[model samples]
Target: MKFSKAEIDAVIAASPRTNLPLSKLVLSEERQVRPQGSTPKLSVAELAASIKDSGVLQNLIVVKGARGLYEVCAGGRRLEALTVLAQADDIPENYPVPVLIVPTDKALIASLAENVFHIPMHPADEYAAFARLIGAGKSVEDVAAAFGVTPLVVKRRMKLAAVSPRLMAQFREGQIGLDCLMVLASCDDHVRQEQVWNGMPSWNRRPAYLGQLLTQGEIESDTDPVARYVTLKAYEKAGGTLRRDLFSDDDKKAYLLDTALLESLATAKLQKKAQQIAAQGWKWVEVRARYVFEEFVKFGELRKTRRAPSGEEAAAIASLQSRLETLRARMDALQDHEGDDDNDDREFLKLDAEGEPLEAQLKALQESLCVWPPELMTQAGCVVFVGSKGTAEVKCGLVRPDDRNGVAEVARKASEVDGDGESLVSLPSAKTRPVHSEKLTRRLTAHRVAAVQAELTVRPDVALVALTAQLAHSIFRDDARGYHRPETVFAITAADCQSDLPTAAEDLQARILDVVTEAVDANAASPLAALKKADAANGAEQTVAATGWLPACLRTRREAGMATEETLQDAPERAASEALAA
Candidate 1:
C-alpha cells in the first residue's frame, strides 16, 4: 500500500520500525526543516558524544531510496553524528541505526512531523529532572556529559531546583520570573527565601532590591575596602563564611557574613603598619581602619622636604627606569603585531608583567626620598589609615596646636643664631577658584527662591506685571530656536472655564449683553452690513497703543492702597505690553 505526504495520520501512526546499516543511510534534501542558512541546533561533536554515551533513544524517520539505501527524512542531525562516529572509528562501519521506515511520498510530512510537532520541556521541569538525576546519585559531570552541556549548567540547574518549593510552584505557575527565581536561589536558606518572597509586594519585587534584602546584613567583598585588603582567600583561611552568588557571572563576587572578623583583620594589618611608622621616632602613631576627615582636621599638617637621592639609590632608579622603558617599547611593538598570532600576545603580556613591578619599585624609591625632618618629626605625629582603594596610607608631620607654637618658637631661636630663618611649613593650599561647589550653589539658590516667593506673595502689583511680561514673552516672542526659557516657576496650563452664571458684576454683565445685542440687531437690520464695525475695530486697535490697554485678565492686580493707572503706566512690562499691542 502507498501513502502520500499529506497522509500524516497514516504515515505517523503505522510507520514500520527497522534497523539499517549506518553505511546504507543517506541524508535526503527534504530533511532540511530548519530555516535556510540558519545554524544547526546541536553541535555535531556534542551529539556524537551523547549518542556514544547512550545509543540513539529516538528513532530516525526515513524512506527507501535508490541503490538499496535508506534516505533519512527526519533526525538528519543524528545521522550526521552517527556518520562522524563511524568515520572516526568510534562506531563500526556497518553499525545498525534504529529508524522508522515510511513511504517515499510521505518523506516531507514525516520530517515536518518530527521537527514541527516537537515541544521543548519547560525550564522548571528541566531543573526538577536534573535534581532528580542528582538525587539518583548521578554526578553533575556525568549528567553534563550525557546531556551535552557543561558542568556549570548542570550545577546552575541544581541550584534553581534548590529554591523553596512554594516559590518554585509560583515559578511554574508564572507568578515569579526566572530572574527573580535565580535571585532567590542565591541564598540556600529556603525558609528565608520564602519569607522574602512572601513579605514583598508585587510592585517592589525587583531582582536587585530582592538581592539587597537577602544580603542586608552581609558585607560585599567586591566593594568593601577591608574585604579587599584582607582578601577573600585569607578570610576563608581564617574560617569566615562567605555567601556566594551563583547568579553573578563573576565567581569572585561574594558577601562576607562575618564583618567583625574582616574588621579585626584590617585593624591588625593597620596596627602592624602603624608600629613600623612609630619606629621612625614619631611621638605617637595611631591606626584607623578608615580615614575620618573631622578627627584629623584639629591637628596641624606639615609639608615634606624631598632630599636628593643617594648615589646607590640613583643608580638603582636609573636601572629600573631603563628596564621599564625597554619593556614599554617592546609592548608597543607587540601591540601593532597583535592579531591571530599567539606569540605576539604572549610577548605583550610578558612585557606588561615585567613593567608593573619595575614601575612600582621606581615609585617607591622616589617617594621614600620625601621625608619629614627629624626636628619636625619629634613635634608631629603620624596616622596610618586605610585609603579608598584598600591600601595602607600614612599621614605624617601632624603637629598639635600647642606643639605648633613651640616649634615656631624653636625656629625663631634658631633664626637668631644663623640669621636666615626657615618659614613654618604648612599643608598645600587649595588653588584659588569658585569657593562654593555646584551643589552648595544650588542649595543657596533654592533658599533664595523661598525668600523671593515669600516677598512676592505680598507684592501683587509686581506679581501681575511679572506674569503679564512672562505671558507676553511666550505669545509674542520669536523663540523658535528654543533658547528662550520662562523665568517664572509657575506652570500655566490652560483650560476652558464653564459656568452657569456670569463672573462679572451684574451691572457690568448687563452692559456687555446690551452692546452685543445692539451689534447683532444693527447687522441684521441694515441693507448693507454696517462699516461701523470696521470703525470700531480700528478704534480698538488704536486704543491698544494709545492707552496701553490690556485685557482685565492680563492687567496687573493692584494693591489695596495702590493707584492702578499710575503704577501700570510706570511699569516696564506695561511698556512691553504696549509695544506688543502696536
Candidate 2:
C-alpha cells in the first residue's frame, strides 16, 4: 500500500492512455453555465472575435463516458463559439482543440466549484450558479463560503434569479431599479409581476419614474394584470397628476370649529322641516273635508227636474172642456120642456140632464189630468231612507207614532226646500272617521320620523360630505392647538370659509361640525397627551407596529412636509393610525 513519491508519480504517469482526437473530444461534450453563472467568462462579442481570430481560448474539459465517448465538464460556450466561427469561415474548417480528461463525478464537481468561486457576476448570475451547485447536491453553506458572501445574501440572490427571466432582463436594462425589482421578486403572483413589468417605460431614460409608475399602477389596477398595465400607461400619457394641498396649522384649526357649528344647524333645520310637513298634512285633511261639505250644500238645491206640459197638450184639453160645457147646457134646456109633459117624460128628461152633468165632470177630469204628475223632491235628513214610508220610518227612525207631528213638519220643510215634491234627502257625513288608534298612530308617526332620520344619516353623498368636513376639522384642530380662537373655528361654519368641506351641503356641514367639536375638545387638553390619545384612538397601533404608514414611509422621502407641530405629531403612532384608517 505504501510507495515513494517517485514511485507514485511514475504510477500516475503510467495509469492510462487514450487515442481520442482532440476535436472530437471537445465537440462531443456540453457544459452548463452556472445558475448564478455570470454573463460568461467572456462576452459574446469578445469570444466570437477570439474564435474567429485564433481559436478556443482554453482546452475544453471533459469526463470519459461509456465506450470511447466523452461528456463536457466545462467550457461548453467556447467550443460552440469556435464551431460557429469555423462554420462562418472565420476559423479553420478542421481545427484541433485541447482537451482534459477527468472522472465524471470529479468533472462535475470541478465545473460547479469554478463557477461558484472564481467570477464577479451580477446578483442574478450568482444566484443561478448557486442554484446549479445546489441542484448538483451542493450545500448552501458551502456555496455561500465559496462565493465569499453571507448565506442570506446567497439565498436572496437565488430568489432574485428565480424571478421570471423577463423581469431579470428588465433589471439588467434598468427599466426598473433594484428596489422595485426586489419588490416584484417578493410577490408570488405572475399577473402582478407582469403588471409591474409592462407598466414600466422603456429603460433608456427615467427608469425611476417608470418604477414609480409601475408601483402606482399595481396599487390602482384591478385583478387583471394586462388591464392594469394598459390603464397605467394610458393614465400617464393622459396627463394624470397626484397632487395635494397642505394647510397651515392656523388654517386647519379655523376650518374644524366652523364646520361643527354649521353641521349642527343643518341637522336642526332638517328635523324642523320634517315636523312642519307632518303638521301640514293633518291640516290639509281637515280643510279638504270642510270644503267638500260646503260644496255639497251649495249644489244640493238644484238637482230637481221641472213638471210643466207642452203647449199642444194644453190646447187639446181646453177644446174638450168647451164641448162638454155646451152639451151640458143643451141637456138642461131639453129637460125644462119635458117637465110640462107626462111624469115618465119628466123623469126621462131629468135622467138625461143628470147624465149630461156626469159627462161634463168626466171631461173636466180629463182636462186636469193632461199634464204628467210632478216628480217628488228629494229631502236632506239625518238618515237617507229607501222603501215605503212605514218601513223607512221603522228602520231609520224618520218618524214614530208619537212623533207624527214631527214627521209632518219634516215633510213640510222638505217640500218647501225642494221645489218638486221629492222625499229623498242626502245629509253631510264625516268622510274620515276617527279610526287611527292612539298607540298605532304614535308608533307610525315615530317610525316615519326615524326613517327620515335614518335616510338622512345613510345618504352616501351626505356621508361623503360629512367625512370630508370631519377630516378638515381634524386637520384644523391639530393646527390650532394653543392659540385656538372661537371665531377662527366658527369661520368654517360660514358658507365659503372651509373650502375642503364635501360638496354635499347638508351632510358635509353636519360632519364638519362634529369633527370641529371633537378637534377643539382634543386640542383643549395637554397638546402632547391629546395628540397621543388621538393617535391611539385613530388605530395607529397596527400601522406604528408595522412601520408602514405613509408618513413614516415618506418621512425620509424627498417631498416630506415642512417641520411644524402638526408634522411633529405625525410620528409613528399618529401617522400609522391615520394611514391604516385611510
Index of the highest-TM-score prediction: 1
Q: Report residue 513 deviation for candidate 2 (angstroms).
A: 34
**Model 1 Cα lDDT, one tens digit per residue, 1-582:** 444556777777788988989999988876556543343656777788789889998999888889898888788888888988898898998998999998877677778877766898888998999999999999999999887788888899999999999999999899999999999999999999998998999999999989989999898988988889889998999999998887799978989999888888888888988989999999789877788888887787766656789999999999999998888887888777736888888878888987888999999999999877667678788888878898999998887766767766654564566464555455334346543446544544444334335544776665666577667655654434333333322222211111121212211222332333343444432332243544444433332233333223323433444233334333444433333222
Candidate 1: which stretches are off by over 4 Å?
A: 1-9, 35-46, 194-206, 294-300, 303-376, 399-453, 459-582
Per-residue CA lDDT of model 2 for 273-341, tens digit only, reads 335433422111111101123333422121223344458646765665666566667656667664465
Global lDDT of model 2: 0.44
**How many steric clashes between backbone atoms does each model show?**
0, 25
Give residue 149's lDDT in candidate 1 (0 to 100): 83
TM for candidate 1 is 0.59
Among residues 3 or more apart in sequence or in different chains, the pairs in candidate 1 whose N, CA or C atoms overlap within 3 Å are: none
